[model samples]
Target: MEAALSLPATLVAKLIEDAERHGMSVDEYCRAILSESRAGDRSSAQAAVINEPSLDDLKLEQLSVERLSLTAVGRTFESGALSGHINRLLPLKIGCRVLWSLLSDEGVGPTIREFREEMWSRVGSLRDYLRMIDEDYARPRGDRLHASFPNSSDAAIKRFLNQYIIRKSGLNAEQSSGAMIDFGLIGISDTGRVQFTEVGRNFSLLSNPVLDEEDHRGPSLSADEQVLILSQIRTEMMREWKFMRHVLDGIHVGSNTPTSLLARINRRYGPGTKADWSASVMPHMRSGVLGRMQALGLVKRTFIENRVEYRVTPLALVILEADVV
Candidate 1:
């Protein structure tokens, strides 16, 4: 039987909201937190390093019914049912310790006006956004930034937003969430005022500032875009490196078996490594680095001694010359 849980009205609302946002029922979201906590207990390897429960995991656990119902369920649940439930939900910690972490780096919150300004700095005149939505205007293929459009807009905007933004700067819709007040990024009060969250401030700062102070003479792309472009290139290279490393490691050790490689990769990077990391490394590698390298003709598949292997092409020699690790 379900108990009448005496949780703060606001906390209950937040739980329901978060559960919906994740596309899970409140019950499912709650259970997932418990499941994650239990899994953590079984893995000593991860616990050795990240002794504290990650902020993300803790927040999710805070939404769980078992946790929220702890104090005031009024004997509805069995005696030991909620006894250790709260302890299980709390992340592993030696003591209440704070560290020099990224969470602390998110400085003071921005005002609503500052939030709007930051968005405007990236998106520029809403002319493009409005034109797409109101007039059904489509930016030409050549004008597309990163070959995509803004996400907050309709098909026309979605198709063109990334293209326009990246050509001007390498920032894309997924990174910036277009120019809208994303509820995920910022918080909204019951009275309908925008609240600057830590994440919201970080996201706002990601966009290039309005005035290009350093580069007096504006170049082909703004400094922010150039930095972003370089970062993107590096990220692309790293992904390739990981894929290459996975394959090269196997090949050098005389084990190019796909199943064996997958097993090794999964052990190193699967579920316990980080929150929301893929359980199967194959899917990410397949469509990402492998697909890109194949399209670029940097590697080719070959059959050698009754085993399938990927050999680096002559064109990829330059890449191999560098220290892969």
Candidate 2:
């Protein structure tokens, strides 16, 4: 049996917050609370716990199930999307958070025009971002700025990657989306919106303005933090990439080129791939797989016995042997 009682806006908001905190639905939370109540009321011992006050100044209006304000949604969305912790990882595109929020909802996500307006509001023009990038590159570093140690120069590079967008060519939405798809971070939903892969969602959120700035900027995060970011990146890469580990392993076990590496892989799998190497499948293994790994300091291309060969980097070896805690 059940009954309905319209809750005050304040109480409903609190209930929603508490439900989310405990990973419970509103009905479940309310049922639990009722179950805990002795005869529908707290005992004398529990009476000390403050009861909900009827404060006129609190804007305690009746709950409206039909419509909730955008500010309310924004508050909930930004609580996770724009939080400081997430803002330090990847330099997210301006509307990335908005895109994510919309995706989290049921219906269709925001249209391209709506997304572009948000971008324009946040960043006036393309040159504005370029100028910010210029500023970032110009910031004085290590010994030069007398900020800290020398060899580790101040460099934080994340060029505002758009998760999914449709804008002018200057935004490079298509190219950015292509790179993300190649990296296996996102996929196209049936509704034509970007959807985060499992590891992609777990990676970490990032704000546009100060994103990746923590890698350098005014106050750098601790070494543990820095390594954590890299570790997460590596984990996500491994989760999505099919050929990276294989290619790296082949290199470690003395396979120079794709033909040689493919031969090695064929030993584990059936035969055929070595003889039937196609660009569509392998797709520039050296530049595509190994090169992306190189960006993460995972592998290096060097001349071995007068032949260009890929070698696993020290960072990759360290991660393989022992991941940093």
Candidate 3:
């Protein structure tokens, strides 16, 4: 004999009523309820079992030493890439996007979703607006649009618009009318198509808080100052020229300091100490002197063997060369 089924008549009646309301049969409703109960139970059990990190935890992890080191180097290179010239001015928009992308990606490849979400958080929907701008004024390329300003990825463009343009302009008005009009960044034609005026392009490029001239102060050091600094650097390098060269040539092909390699130099050139060398050079090198060289792309640092190692950059070779030998 079949086992007796159990269910309250009132509950069955209520289920039937709900099923009728939704136009589902009693059998269908029961199946759905059972499936839903199982799903809910699974979800609750999973919630209890898994110990997922919160956004804050993720953020903290992102800020750890390993992440920070990569971020620092990536940011340095990103800035270098955008500016092209070491001392050239970068608009606020460009700067913000560059920084946000670097931080979000944590020095890895670009994340378009994170960038898009960042844009949506700041502005409504950047896609349609960007498309409109591209259709009206920009020339389309392979996967990007070229406007009067530099060509960049959509995420890059959106971040630039959000942090630099919208925030700086303080445009919080309705999407179609107030902000764009008040800021004079966009216009609607009689046919209702968005048209970019010359003034709009000029404002976007020059007036946008992100890419304005204020942040970029051109070259920080003059040619004469550069010459003086390079002279000092060369003088210091000459003291250990043969030693450094030998170290460079013989060093293991990886991120490593010259110490192990410099053993060769010590053997050939005698016992010279980095501490003594630094002490001697530190007096002649003023504060911000190394920073100036970095800005000029003359030197860079690498982390190897849990320590920082400095080396001359490619640009330094051109700048530091003697006439012949």
Each model's lDDT = 0.35, 0.41, 0.36
For residue 78, model 2's alpha carbon misses the true position, in angstroms, by 32
Residue 261 in candidate 1 has what lDDT?
57
Residue by residue across 1-325, what tens digits does model 1's lDDT show?
9987798999889989999999999999999989998898878767755553122321222222221111100001111111111111000010000000112123222333343333333332333332333233343322222222133545544333322111112332222321122112234333322333333333233322112122212221333433332233334335434544555555345544556655665665557754224755344553343333432445455656877566565545554565456
lDDT of each residue in 90-196, candidate 3, tens digit only:
22223233323334223332233343345444332223333444455432331121221223466656544442333222232223322223223333333332333
Q: Highest lDDT: give the candidate number.
A: 2
Residues 1-325, model 2: lDDT tens digits: 6788778999999999999999999999999988888645656445534432211111113212122111101101111111111222222222334344444234234444454445444332333433444465575321121211112212211122232233223444333232334333344444444555443333324222223332334322333433443554455444323355666677877896656875664554333543344444443333444544543456656665856667787767775566433
Q: Is 1 or 3 the stronger prediction by lDDT? A: 3
* Per-model TM values vs. the true structure: 0.27, 0.36, 0.23
Task: State the RMSD for candidate 1.
Answer: 26.4
* Candidate 2 deviant stretches above 4 angstroms: 1-108, 111-199, 204-210, 214-242, 256-275, 279-283, 301-309, 318-325
- With candidate 3 superimposed using the best TM-score fit, by how many Å does residue 250's alpha carbon deviate from the native? 22
- Model 2 vs. true fold: TM: 0.36
